[model samples]
Target chain A: MTPALELSSIEGGYEPGLPILRGASLAVAPGEIVALLGPNGAGKSTLVKAAAGLVPIWSGQVFLNGRDITRTPAHRMVQEGLGFVPQTENIFANLSVLENLQLAAALVPKDRRGELSKMFALFPDLERLRKLPAGRLSGGQRQMLAVARALVASPSVLMLDEPSAGLSPKLIGVVFERLQAVREAGVTILLVEQNVKAALAIADRAAVLVEGRERLVGAAADLAQDPRLAGLYLGAGLEAA
Target chain B: MLQLLADGLVVGSVIALGAVGLTLTYSILRFANFGQGEFLTWGAYLAVTALGFVVAVTGGGVMQPIGPFSFGWELLVAMVIAAALTAGLALLVDWLLFQRLRARGAAITLVIASFGAALALRNLLQFLYGTLPEYYTREIQIAIRLVPRDVLGGLRITPDQLLVIGMTGAVVLGLHLLLTRTTLGRAMRATAMNPALARVAGVDVAAVIRATWIIGAALAAVAGVFAGLVGQIRPGLGFELLLPLFAAAILGGIGSVWGAVLGGFIVGLAESFSVPIFGAEYRAATAFLVLIAILLLRPNGLFGEKP
Candidate 1:
C-alpha cells in the first residue's frame, strides 16, 4: 500500500546557520498511528513543521500520498488532504467554536459533505459549545476544539504536534481515546509526543528524533521495551543498561 | 438658539459623511491614515472643476436650480466622478507607498508616511487650485425652514444640508447591507479580525485591501464634495476635516462600521454646537477636544474595542 506520508531525507530550517531538521526521514501507511518521540529541543516540532510546509525545506523532498509536495504552502497542504494542528496557538480566540469548524468545513470537497458530517459525530462536545467563543473553552476543551476544527476538513492524513501538551492526565487519556477513534476511521495519524511510554503503547510505529536528526526508527513496542528509554527521557540519569 | 441646532444638524451631516471613509479605512487597513483627509479635499476640488466644466458646456448658471430640491446634474455627475477618481488615486498611494511599507514589515513608519502623504496631497492641491476659496455655483432654489421663529434670528436649513443628511442615511444603509449580506464582506471581516488565519482560510487578502481602499477613498471624496457644498472649497478643506472625521471613527471604534457613523454625527454636532459658544473659528478644534474627552473617558472611541 502507498504510504500516507513519506519524507525522503529532508533538511529544513527557519534560519541559515542552524538547520532544524537535517536530512531526517520517515513514513507511515494509511490507518496507522505513528509516534514521533524526542527529548525537549530535539527538532521534533521542526520536522513536522517542515513536512507540513510551515518551515522552509532547504533540501530533500516530501510526499503526501505519493504526490511531491516539497514547497507547498500550509493552506494548500490542507486542500491536498493533509491537516496539521500546531503545538501552540491552534485556535482563534475571538471567533465562536462553530465559526472555527465552519472555516474548516468550508475547505472540504463539496461531494464529501455527508462523510464530513459523520466525522463530526466523533467529538460531540464541540457541537454543544459550537456557538461559544473559543477563548472561554477549558484547556482540554480547547485542544479538542482544535482537533475538531482540523478533522472537520475530512483530511486523509492528520499530523498533530503534542496535542496533549498542556492537558491534565485525565484529559490526555481523553485526547488519546479520540485519536484511537480517529485511527479506527481509516485515516493515517502521525503524532509527536513528549509523553513517551503512553504514546508508544498506542503507536504501531515509532521514530526517535535528536537535534535535527532521527537517531532511531522501529516498531513502537520494541522501542518501549528497550531499557535505555528510561535514561534518555527520565531525569534520574541514564541507568546502566 | 434653536437655529444653532438646525445648523448643528447640517454640519453634523457633512462630518458624518466625510468621517465614514476614514473610519472604514482605519477598520480595514488597521491604521490611522492621516492622508485620508486629503482625499476629501481632492474629491471636492475635482468635483468643482469637473462639474463647473459640465455646467459651462451645458450653458447653465448659478442662478438656476437644477430641479426643485438641490444641486444640478453637474454636481451629481461631478460627485460620482470625484469619488471614482479619489478611490483610484488612493490605490495609487497604496501601490506606491503603503503596500511596499507593509511588505517590508514597517508598521509605525507607515503611519508617519501617511501623514507625509496627506501633506504632499494638500500642497499639490494648493499648487493646482491656488489658495482661493471657491464655491459651486448654487443651482438649488428651495430653502427649507424648520427652526422656530423666535430662535437665533431666523435660522434656516439649505436644500444642500437636507440633501447631505439624506445621502448620509443612504450611504450607511448601503454599506450595512453590503457588509452583512455579501461573501466579499464576510471575507473582509475575517481578514480584519485575523489576516494570516483568513489567508489560511482561502481569502484573497490583497484583493480585500484593494477593495477597502476603493471604498474608503470613495467615501472620503463624496464627503469632501458635501463639505464644499455646505461650506467652502479649498486645499485645507480636508486637512481641517480630518480631526472630526477621525473623532467619529474613533468614537465608533476604529474598525467598526456602525461606530464610525455614530462617531461622525456626534463629532459633527459637537463641533457645530461649539461654534456658538467658541465662535466658528473654533469648530475644527472642537473635534480634538471631544476626542480628548472621549480618550480620557473610554479611550476606544464610543463603540470600538481597544486596539
Candidate 2:
C-alpha cells in the first residue's frame, strides 16, 4: 500500500542555506502509527515540519498518498488531508475549549462542521470544561484539548510534535490511549516523541533518528529491544552486559 | 460636571470607534500601524466628497436638513459610501505596503513603513482638499438641555452628539457579538494568539487578514464621520487625534475590545475634565499624561497581559 505520508530524501530548514534536514526521509502506511524517536537536535521535529510545509523544503518531494504536496502552503495542507499539532501553542490558550474545536471545524465544509459532538464524545472531560479557556486547563487537559482540536478538522493523517513532552506519566498513558483510538477510527498518525517506551507501546513502527538522519526503522516490538536505541538515546554506545 | 460627562460621552464614542479598529489591527498584525489615523482623515474627506457629489448630481434636493439634525439623507448615504471606500483603501494599502513588509518579517520594518504610509496619506489629503478645515454641514444647531439647571448644573447635548453615542453603542455591541459569537471571530482571536497554529488548524489566514482590514477601516470611517459631525475636518484633524487614540487603546489594554471602550471613556473624561483644571489649551497634553500614568501604574494597561 502507498504510504499515507512519504518524505523522500528531504532537505530543508528555516533558512535557505542552513538545512537541518539533509536527505532525511520517512514514510507511514495508512491507519498506522509511526513513532519518530530521537534525542534533542535530532531534526525529528524539523522533518515533520518540512513534511507539513511549515519549513522550507529546499530539495525534496513530500507526497501525501502519492500526491505531491511539496511547497504547499501550511494553511492549504489541512484541506489536502494534513493536520499538524505543534508541541507548544497547539491550542489557542485564550479561547475556550469549545471555541478551539469550532475554529478547527470551520476549515471544513459547512455540512461537515458537526465534529464538535464527536470530539466531545471522545473527550468527555473537555465537554465538561468546554466553557473554560484552554490556558486555564491543566497540562494534561491542555494536551488533550490540543489533540482533540487537531482531530476536529478530520484530516486523513495527524502529525503531532511531542504530545507527551511535559505531560505527567498518567496523562501520557491517557494520550497514548487516545492516539490508539484515533488510529482505530481510520486516521494515520505520525508522532515525534522523546518517550521511547511509551511511544513503542502505541506505535506500529518506530524510527530512530540521529543527526538529521534515520538510523533505524522497523517493527515497534523489535525496535523496543534493540541495543542501538539505548546507545543512541544516551549519546554513548552501550557496553555488552 | 454633568455637562462634562455629556461632552465626554460624545468624545469617548468617537475615540472608542477609532480605538477598536486600532486595537484590532494592532492585535492581529502585531504592528502599531501609525498610518491608521489617516484612515480617519480619509474617511472624513471621503464622506464629504461623496456628499458633495450627491448634492451636485441631485441639484441639492437631498441637502435639506432632517428635523433637528443639520445633516440630510445625503450625509447618511455619504457615511456608508465613505465606509466602503475607506475599507477598500485600507485593503489596498495593506496589499501595496503592509503585506509586502509582513512577508519580509520584521515588526520594526512594518512600524516604519506605517509611519511612511501615514505621512504620504496625510499629505495626499492636504494636497487634494487643502489645509483649511471643512464641515459636513454649515448650520450650527443649538444643544438641547437634557438635565434641568437647578437639579444638575444643566446638562445639554446636540442631536448629533446623541447620534454619535447611539451609533457607538450599536457598533461596539455588534463587534462584541462578532468577536465572541462567530467562527470568523474565533479564527481571528486564534490567529491573534498564534498565527502558525491557526494556519495549521486550517484557517484561511489571508482571508482573516482581509476581514480584519475591512472591519477595522469601516469602524474608523464611522468615527471619522462622527468627528466631522462634532468638530471640523482638516488635514491635521486625524493627526491631532492620533495621540489620544493611542492613549485610549493602550489604556484599555492593547488587544482587548472591551478594554478599548473603557479606556476611551477614561481618556475622554480626563480630557473633558482637564479643560477646567488645566485650561482648554492643555487638553491634548492631559490625554498623554493619562497614558503615561497608566503605563507607569499598570504597564500592561487595564486589560493587557504582561509581556
Candidate 3:
C-alpha cells in the first residue's frame, strides 16, 4: 500500500547552500502514527517543514497519497489534505481559541471543514476556553489548540513538530493520549518529537534521523529495545558497531 | 472648549481613517509603509479628477449643494470611484515594488523601498496635478452654532465637518465588524499574528495581503476625499498628515484598529487644545509629544501585547 505521506531524498534548509536536511527521507503509512525521532540539529523538523512546504526544498519530492506536491505552496498544502503544526508559535496567540479554529476551518472547502464540535469534543478544555485568547492558555492547552487547529482542516495527514516540547510529563501523557485518540479517529500522523519514550509509546513506527538523514527505521516496539537507537542519538555511527 | 472639541473631532476623523490603514498594513505586512501617505494624496487627487469627470458627464446640476452639505451626488459618486481607483493604485504599487522587495525577506529594505515609492508617488501626483491647491467645491459652508456662548464656550461646526465625523464613525464601525465577524477579517488577524501558521492552516497569505492593500487604500481614499471637502487638496496634503498618522497608529498600538481611532482622536484633540497655550505654530508638535509620552509609559501601545 502506498504511504499516506512520502518524502524522498529531501535536501533543504532555511537558506540556500546551507542545507539542514541532507537526503532525509521517510514514508508514513495511512492510519498509522510514525514518530520522527532525532537529536539536536538532526534536521527532523526541517524534514517535515520541507514536506509541508514551509521550508524551501533544494531538491526532493514530497508525495501526498501518491500525488507529487513538492512545489505546492504552504497555504495550498491544507487544501491538498496535508496539515503541519510548528513546535513554537504554532497557535495564533492574538486570536481567541474559537477564532483560531474558525480561521483554519474557513480555509478548507466547505465540505472538508471538519466539525468544530468534533474537535471541541476531543479537547473538551478547548470548548471551555473557546472564547479566551490562545496566548493565555497553559502549555498543554496551547498544544491541544494547535493540534485542533491543524485537525480542523480535516487533512489526510497531520505533521506535528514537537508538540510535547514545553509541557510537563503529566501534560505530555495527556497530549499523547489525545494523539492516540486522534489516530483512532482515522488520520495519518508524522510526529517530530524529542520525547522519544512518550512518542514511541504511541507511534507504531519511528524513524531516527541523524545528521540530516534517517539512519534507523523500525517498528516502535522493537526500536525501543534496540541499543543502537540510543547510540544513533549519541552521535555514534551504527556502522562502528 | 466645545469649539476646540468639535474641530479636533473633525481632524481626528481623517487621522483615524488614515491610521487604520497604516495600522493594518503594519500588522499584516510587518512594515511601516512610508508610502501610505501617498495613497491618501493619490486618493484626494483621484477624487478631484473623478469629480470633474462626473460633473462634466452629468452636467453642472450634479455639482449643486445637497441639503446642508457643500457637495452633491457628483462628489459622492466621485468619492466611491476614487476609492476603487485608489485601491487599484495600492495594488499596483505592491505588485510593481513591494512584492519584489518582499521576496528578498528584509523588513528594513521594504521600509526603505516604501520611502522611495512614496517619493515617486508624490512626485508623480505633483507632475499630474501641479503644486497649486484644488478644491472639490468653492461653495462656502457657514458654521452652525450648536450651543449658546455661555455654555462651556459654545460650539460651532460646519456641515462638511459633521459629515466627516459621521462618515468616520460608520466606516470604523464597519471595519470593526469586518475584523470581528468575517472570515477574511479573522484571516487578516491570524496572518498578522503568525503568518507561517496561517499558511499551514490553509490561508492563502498572498490573497490576504492583496485584500489588505485594497481595504487600506480604499479607506485612505475616503479620508482623502473628506480632507479635500473639509479643507483643500494638494500634492502635499497626505505628506502633511503623515506625522500625525504615524503618531495615531503607534499611540493606538501599531496593529489595533480601535487603537488607531482612539489615538487619532487623542492626537487631534491634543493638537487642538494645545493651540491655545502653545500657539498654532506648535499644533503638529503635540502629536510628537503624545507619541513620546505613549512610548515612555506604554511601549506596547494601549492594546498591543508585550513583545
lDDT of all predictions, in order shown?
Answer: 0.79, 0.89, 0.93
Model 2 pairs whose backbones collide: B252-B259
For residues A71-140, write the lDDT of model 2, one tens digit per residue.
Answer: 9999888888888889987899989998898888887767545478888888889999999988899988
lDDT by residue for model 1 (A1-241), tens: 7799998898889888788888988998888999999788878888888887778899998888999989887667777778778777677665677767665666556753324356458777877887898878998888887787777667788889999898988999999999999888777899999988779878999988777676677899999887766655543333442
Compute each candidate's TM-score over C-alphas: 0.83, 0.97, 0.98
DockQ, all models? 0.26, 0.83, 0.89
- In model 3, which regions exceed 4 Å deviation? B60-62
Every candidate's chain B TM-score: 0.92, 0.97, 0.98
Q: How does the DockQ of candidate 3 come out?
A: 0.89
User: What TM-score does structure 2 among the candidates reach?
Assistant: 0.97
lDDT rank order: 3, 2, 1
- Candidate 3 is scored at a TM of 0.98
Q: Would you list the rank order by TM-score, best first? A: 3, 2, 1
lDDT of 2 at B171: 93
Candidate 3, A134-219: lDDT as tens digits: 99999999999999999999999999999999999999999999999999999999999999999999999999999899999999
Model 2, span B1-307: residue lDDT tens: 8999889888888888888899999999999988878999999999999999988787554588889998888898899999999999999999999999899869999999999999999998899999898999998899898899986678988998998899899999999999989989998999899998888888878999999999999999899999999999988777877888899999999998999898888888899999999999998898899999998999889999877
Q: Which candidate has the highest TM-score of all?
A: 3
